[model samples]
Target: MAAPVITVSNKSLLHDQWQLLQPWFSYFDADGNPAVRYQLWDSGATATSGYFWTPTNAHWPANTTIDVAASDISNVWLRSGSAGGSETLWIRGFDGTDWSGWATFTFTTIPNSLPVATVEDQSLHVNQWARVSTLLSYSDANGDAATKYQFWDSGTAATSAHFWTPTNSHWAPNTTIEVSAADLANVWIQGGSTTGSETLWVRAFDGFNWGAWDTFTVASTNAKPVVAVADHSLHVNQWTRVGSWMNVSDANSDTITKYQFWDGGTAATSAYFWTPTNSHWAANTTIEVSASDIGNVWIQGGAATGTETLWVRAFDGTEWGDWDTFALTTTINTAPVATINDQSLHVNQWVKPGSWLSATDPEGDTITQYQFWDGNAAANSAYYWSSSNAHWASGIAIDVSAADLGNFWLHAGAAEGSDTMYVRAYDGTAWGNWDSFALTSTNTAPVATISNQTLNAAQWAQLVNWTAASDADGDAITKYQFWDGNAGANSAYFWTPTNSHWAAGIAIDVAAADLTSLWVQGGTAGGSDTMYLRAFDGTEWGAWHSFVVTTAV
Candidate 1:
């Protein structure tokens, strides 16, 4: 009989050494024999002691003889050796009367299987932490667990700047770490600041070879930045800066890009507001993507002064943060100033003062009133002219208003003596310092007389013995003057003394020589010639003194 056709099917499997494997084998006998057996060997064409397939026992027996029937030929089984290498099996089929040729089969056995990794995608906002191992997992075909792992950025191995810890600490790309180390080190991850998708390449090792790199996507979202502003104080006409009282920060280390401000109170009318470059902003405004756009702010003079609550917000190339408050206190207000100088006036004199009694207000306010007192008693109500009830005993204050200061008069009760007049000016808000002036009341005028004299037509009368002058108030009679007919210099010339008259020219000084030289000349046809005389008491002239001159024609 011809040898039965031998066919051995080889199976490739990842198994541990000394594990069992089942392979199918078949043969066709040409003589149509009912009994056919198969024999298997370990090497090429050399019948060494290996195994024989047995269908009833469902196992392979170690025998060099072909003791298995053709019915059990399909039940071929093999044993993986104790070591891994190129594995070969030699097999032959025999009929009841003829032996078949040996058939050879070749295959390889691996000692350890590679571990494969599967990574899961993750999604989170910026600044949130991500665990490394939580996104990575692996399995081995040889039933081996993952022993170590290495991760990289989206690109190939050794790529940097892909992962980081909460504190921003990072490991280099493709960094190898044992699975136990990953657990002990608490490795976390942080994506880039840009809001988008990120990729991480991961590979695992089962104490053998590393598997293929797998990737996990990290979807990042925008995060808002935090801002803080401190309280600020400024004068009504002063200003504060932006960075001086403001603090800007971010959680994801993002740059500050935008800012908005609010004005909580009335703006200064004259110089409303300004930016860093002194550019005026008629109203509150905002800036975007520019640094220090609002470097400083101005609070002009005469602005409303009070505690105000201002608002500000920030952006980190993302959404805006909550509105923060800036406590602003515009509390500086300078009081108005009033000015007055000392003055001098005579008794019984009503006169309007000059610029000496003027006032000024620092804030340009109006000066409302002035207070007058006696003897520098500025603070004493009893000595000052406050109302209708309190006034100077012999003085008066008039036209006390923003327009003018009319006059100040010293009336009847004022005696001839040295006195003081204190004055203070007032703006609408506050009173100015007191000012004082010296007042001098002069002595009364002197008296002049000429005794009655008789004269004939075309005749002269010696008046030296009749002329006299006196002064009251202990003043000396210093000068004397005479005029005819009480008509002053306009009267017809009826008196002669070297053709020099006292009233029309310089005064005649009181002296023995001057008095004896005085004479009265009669008119041509005069019943009684009236003459006037006056005297000076160094300060004032006394009232005119009249004397009658009797004339006969």
Candidate 2:
């Protein structure tokens, strides 16, 4: 039999020093016999003087030579005897009787490869903290373990911009930190004041060299908006716009697109809320969706009273933010108002100043008391009287009586002048401003004149002159009246003094008429008769004047 001829051998095996090498070969047999066995050598063309190939791997076993069937000629495995160097392998095939010429193959091993870094993107809120270990991973081609990591932060890139040292504090850019300390190495980075995004770069090191930069996008979340307001008061049953009372802002400078409002108390009702155009909405409803729609947003105060809370959340064309609170006090009560006009009355006359009182209360409260007093001034010293407080003395400012506010009298005795009185009103909660009542007294009676007159029987006589009436107040007499004092059958009578029959108590026109038919019959008994006369100025009457008429026998 002929020795098998080596036909092909693996050219070279290039791999890292830490990885195993597997070489392949092909051979031919003489006389149609299949090549069944193979041999390997470490150096120059021969297996005698040089070291023969041996397998250190337990799967193939360490041996002086290798055994393989014809079907497995290409299944040769080899390992580097030392670290990181080029080596040659000699191979030949045997056909049971003879061996083939040696064929050469080379194995090249390189130094430890650069570590490759892997990192996942991260999302963090502004001004928040996250650990670096959770996002970073690495692998080495030469079996070199990653011992540390480095980072480049965009925030402080111009200054201390790298992070490498082991620290629990925020990392500086391009500094190294132990991988073991990664759990403790926290990162706290922030974006601008308003809502926005940001990123960071990181790489791993295997104690020799840093790997390629692995990126981790630190996408900062949108910053939440803030709302502030001072406690406010509302009158019962009153409506007010809330835009001017609230201050809303966002750090990202994002346009505020929407807001949600809800009442923390019962003071906020659905019917009480209104838009700028007076449209109503439910409480806790999100409305005013536009950025410019904040003005004149209306909220009405219900009949109820007390403190109310309003919670608000705003959306800056993004996710909704945290809730902000503001207080709306609904239980503010306002004092009532009292109004009165200057009052006037005659001397010894009584009037109800309460009838002139006008009172108003913002809370719809009723006026519970009407207070009267002298204002500690000369005008307030006027004499006033009431059934309950018979007569109030001068300068008496103290409330003489709580009653009789409706039927109080202002009397300056007989004096004719003006005086001031003050009145105030009270609702259940508070007192109103004082109002003044001015009291005045005027008018005096007139005097009537008449003289005793004599007339013959059967002759016509003119009665006492009605024009002789005079007034102490310089007023002209407005009317004159007369009555007969004579009894039946002797009763003196009077005509219209214009020949027309006149009646008592009927006003007589003094400018045109006097008694012309006043006479006694010639056959009738003759005697003296009495008559009464009275006159009136515009306001009061004068005392009666007495005169007599005598008839001749």
Candidate 3:
């Protein structure tokens, strides 16, 4: 008889499902009356002399082909769930009196279903400790609850560092376990490798196999706080409020515990700290410091100003940050004084009067301008004018006209008189008191006379004499002129003395024909020719003097 042949559809079988096997054999005998039987055995089954057949009868016709279906060999052995191994199936055909050599086939059983696992994402503060646990619900259709788990970081490249496979014995699914602070610290350190967002990976096993990697994300920790102040400047006595003038912010949403300040002197400490009523300092808090608080910062003399530096910093409960700095300046100023040299001046005369100004500030300020006034009014009054006025003269020696001194002349009309002139100095910020001086007008025109203007036409060559001119104000006469008649009435006949003058005393030689021509023009033909003489005292003209000259042709 030929050995029975066994065949399988697949070389390997999954642990979760069953597999089919077929066995057939052919045998021939002369009588064709022998009974044939077949038996099957697995490698794990014990070896025995007795044959184990699928059916109780365990027989088939011989001398012909006989086939055994999968159902006929329903008791064929197979492995499932972690029971897999290199299994061998042995089949043999036997006649009632003869035996056939064994026929064998080999196959393997392998795990097919994968376990289920999930990792939940987390958000926590730095160095925070927690307990993590969840019912893994991990299972393999053919496997038991002996699932294993491990933690992994998404940044790790080699599996060696992440492959910390621990069984569910002490770390069983659904059992809570403490995540040490050190573990959280390590997670934080790893998270630093990828700021803001980091991912953790995990996987589970059903004793014999691992599931797909599952991932969860962790958020990075908070950042430090910052502070700043707006720039500022002020004068010596100025005051300012600090509230709502500074900006404070934190990334972790942490409140500021306190603020510290330094005045370019000692370092800041708790003793010098300012705590807000709200316990937490917010952005734009009002911080005020009075002028008295900065009185010592004011400077005097020398450079005229002083500077101070203020430094500030904030705390966010956890840490103190870097300092922000600001600068301040204090200034000073003083008034000025003025003086005039010439106390008196003459009308219609050009006089260069002396004047000077001086100023000194505790802050060393300089003088800016000098103002002059002609009345008793204040320096800045509208009645007192500025240096820019057309009539104003500015210099060490000022040449001012009496007409510009004041309106006194406009109302007094050149009557010999005296008045006060004022002047003041300025230091840009403050004006000095008005300093005053005297001004006078005294000169008047001189009077003149003709000695003898009566003369015969033939004796016209004789000299005509006039009295020397004199001035009321003691001024010397400058020149003299004469006219045929009163100069005020006959403007056309005015003339200056020529040929005979101061040599013989103020006089002139008049010829007969010139005398006859003067008489004809003056409408004094037969009677007499009247002549007039006048004198000047530089600034004024004197009244004319009259004389008579008889003309007989």
Instruction: List TM-score per model, in order.
Output: 0.29, 0.31, 0.25
| Tens-place lDDT digits, model 1, residues 405-478 | 44443331143455576666665445766666665554577788877777776466566667676665665666
Sorting all predicted structures by TM-score, with the top scorer first, yields 2, 1, 3
Q: Rate the local accuracy (lDDT) of all candidates.
A: 0.57, 0.57, 0.44
Candidate 1: C-alpha RMSD to true structure equals 42.8
Off by over 4 Å in 3: 1-334, 351-365, 376-415, 447-532, 536-553
Return the candidate ranking by lDDT, descending.
Answer: 2, 1, 3
Q: Model 2, range 151-227, lDDT digits (tens) per residue?
A: 66665433222233334444544444344424424543443333344456767777667788876666556667776
- Winning candidate number (TM-score): 2
User: Which 10-residue window of candidate 2 scores lowest in summed lDDT?
Assistant: 44-53
* Model 2 lDDT on a 0 to 1 scale: 0.57
